[model samples]
Each structure stands twice: as structure tokens, then as C-alpha cells.
Target: MDPTPPVPHDLSPPRDVPLRLRPPRHRVDPRARRWWLLRALASAGAVTVVIGVVWWLWEPARPWLTAPLVLAALWTAARAVVEPRVRYAVHRWEATDLAVYGLTGWLVREWRVAPLSRVQTVDAVRGPLEQALGLATLRVTTASSSGAISIRGLDADLAAELAERLTAVTEQTPGDAT
Candidate 1:
């Protein structure tokens, strides 16, 4: 009997293997909840300012506009309080030896799979809000513009780890050199 083993043509999971391409089940840093609340409050504040302006400038229209504006303010507050948790629940990402897989989105579900060979750069980006929350967003760029994807809301350290690992794997992949 021949003892040679079969070579893997690609790093992709077997067709029969159910796509376990979900992000790890770990919860995000607790501070993300506060960050989300802050953003929501900021939005509601803006709406409040607008309502105030309308009330001062158009006294006669106040009755008609006030209710909607107040409702809007309430909705904004509700969104701020509820959306972060909903987002956290829906967000998941996993770094496999062969590829990076993630499911992200609240209303529009997006599934991402970027093979190591196709990864061009892995960036760990943090804005003021993210930095304050000790979080980072990982962006994976590929040769094709449409192939790029970002995994947001990861802990800063975890994002770094994923970026470093992806970069290492990408550098070693064949046919990736210019």
C-alpha cells in the first residue's frame, strides 16, 4: 500500500465542515458598554439642541414639532442603551491558522473570511473613543479592494495579537511576494 499522504490544495476548511467562521464567544471589554452609552447620549443631546432651537424660533409650531422631537430623543436614548449589547451579541471573530473569520453587524449581517495568502496588511486602529475604551479595530486589506474587512470592538491587546499573527502568516504565504 502507498504510504504517501495527500497534499492540501488550499487552506480552506473542508466542504463538509460546517462553517465555524464565527468570532470567539468572548465578551468585549466591559468599558465598551460605557462608550456606547456615551455616543448615544451625545446623539440625543444633538437632537435636544435642535428641539430647543425650533421651540425658540417657532413658538406656534412647537406643539406639532415638540412631540416628534421628544419621541426622537427617547428613541435615541433607547438605542444607546440597547444597541451596544445587541451589537456585542452579534459580533464574533476567530483567527484560524489558515484564515481570519468573522461575523459582524447588527442590522445587516456580514460574514468575512480572509485567507492568509490574500492578506496584504493587518492594521490595528484606535480612535479617541476606542483608545479611551481600551479597544481597537482590526482592518485586513487584500489585493482586491472589495476583499477588505474590519473587525471592530476587539480589546486593544487582542487586536494586536490578531494583527501580528495575520501579518506573520501573510508574509510566509507563497505567491504573495512582488
Candidate 2:
């Protein structure tokens, strides 16, 4: 057998020396439930429309409609409960490249990497729904829309902070003056 020391698996103070930070990355906020709420509200609206049509027309196919509407309601309600919104607290530092990245989402994961030279604008937007929830969405625009990334469902303050940070990073990068 070769004489080699085994690497430590547990790295607590009493155990082994910790190699990395306790938490590698930090979460921006609790998962947002606004999207599912919107979806559920839309689904409910559809069901209302269908019910109104059935009542107004008295169609023979009303029985079949019941099943489909019931199914849709169940699905929408379930999605509202199961899918939670996710946000990320970005920690972007310089490496060899003039680039930064933003990560967001929970059920649907998204990563956006854009070179500082390519970033055109950073904006924080809040819609009616977002306003109701006191949340905002930060959009990072670049020369290429296909490479764009949006960080959604953040508290207004955090979204503004992120937008400022991104803008600052872009402005400070060399060779970006125009």
C-alpha cells in the first residue's frame, strides 16, 4: 500500500482545518411566490370565463368542460404552492477577464455572464405586481440581447443596489469609455 495521508471530510473547529468558507454563496432573499400567485389568478380568471360561457349558452358539452376546468384549477393551485421564487446575492470580483455574472431563479435556473465592455445599461424596474410585493426586477442590457440576464423578484432596495453595482463595475472596467 502507498503511504499517503487521507484528506479530511469534516472541517469543523474541533475537527479539521476548513479549506473554504462555510457558505460558498449567499441567497439574496426568500423565494418569491408572486409568479405562482399571478399564474393562479390567471387560471382562476379563465375558469370564471368558462363558467360564464357555460351558464350563458347552456351548451351540451358543459359536463366535459367541468373536468378540464377542475384539472386546470388543481394544477395551477399545486404549482402556486410547489414553485417558489429564487434570488441570488452576487459576489463579482475581477479575474483575468473583463466579465461579471448574475445568477437568479429557483425552479428555473438562469445564469447571465456579460463582459464589462459589452454592458450598455443597468436598470431596476418595478411593475404593478412587483410594487404590490415591494419587489423589483433588475435588467442588465448589453450590446447583444441574446446574452442578456434579468434578476427578478428582489426587494426594491436590493435590486437597486445590484443595478448600481453592475453599473459601477461596467464603468470602472478599462477601455469602456465612449
Candidate 3:
């Protein structure tokens, strides 16, 4: 067997860090969670209203039908209000590292990380609803067929900036297509 030892990870500032040991890319702006909550609330409200209207028209078992609708509305509203308040932590990308990570949850936190080098493309998609909300979705495509990982409900400017930055990094990497 060869007698070689692995190098320790150098923990230093951006200026002093080596090219390979730089911090990883990560960022989180959960400020737009309110929009998600609003959307969810709107959906629940629409469903409840539809059921109410149907009950008025059809005159079905009032208590049986309305009870579940009421419970669902309350539960959905509670989740909407509560989920957004959960903290989402994001980390910025580092020079040597390609991945950016984000973690979010109240009781059960979840983490998502993407490698900048693996990114095939970055796009800014603005839909009618997002346009009204002044938000955009940043999608990063990877080599896998599962489709891109998209983060939505981000401030337009911030999303654009992040997308541009990621694109630049991806293009600059060696062997990356022009």
C-alpha cells in the first residue's frame, strides 16, 4: 500500500483560502414565504367556497359535507400561516466548491443542495401570478432526467442576480461548453 495522507480542509477567509478548499455556494431568502401562504390560502378558500355553493344548490347532508370542508379549511389555513414562518437557511457558493445548500423547516427541517458545476442551464421564469407578485423562479438544470431543481417565490432582482452569478461560474469552469 502507498503511504500517503489526505490533506486537512483549510478553513480560511475568501482571500486566503485555496482554490479547492473554498467555501460552498449557498443562499436563502425566505421573505417570499408569505406569497406561498397567500396562494395556499386562496386555493383553500376557493375550494371551501365551491363546496359551500354546491351545498346550497344541491341541498346535500349539511353537517356531513360541511364538517369536513370546515376542518380542511381550518387545517389548511393553519398550515399556511405556520409553514411560512419556518426558517430557511441558505449558504452562498464558494470558489472551489460548486454546490449551494438550503435548509428549511419548523419541526422537521429539510435540506437541498445543488452543484454549480453540474448545472446545465439557469433560467428565470416569470408567470402571470409571479409577475403580479413581483417574484420569479430560478431553475437549474442538471444532467439527470428528474428535471431541474427550481426555487420559486424569490424577489425578481435577487433571482436574476443569483442566476447570472451561477451562469458565470458554470461557464468559467474548465471543460464547460461555450
TM-score for each of the candidates:
0.75, 0.62, 0.68
Report lDDT per candidate: 0.71, 0.55, 0.58
Compute the lDDT of residue 147 as modeled in candidate 3.
Answer: 59
TM-score of 1: 0.75
Task: Give me the runs in candidate 1 sitting further than 4 Å from their true place.
Answer: 1-27, 56-58, 144-147
For model 2, give the 10-residue run with minimal summed lDDT: 87-96
- Tens-place lDDT digits, model 2, residues 153-175: 56678677667766776777676
Model 1: how far residue 27 lies from native, Å: 4.1
lDDT of 1 by residue, 82-169 (tens): 7777777777666655676767766688877776677778999998888988988888887765666787877888788778877777
Best by lDDT: 1
Checking candidate 1 for backbone clashes, the offending pairs are 23-92, 23-93
| Candidate 1 local Cα displacement, residue 160, angstroms | 1.8
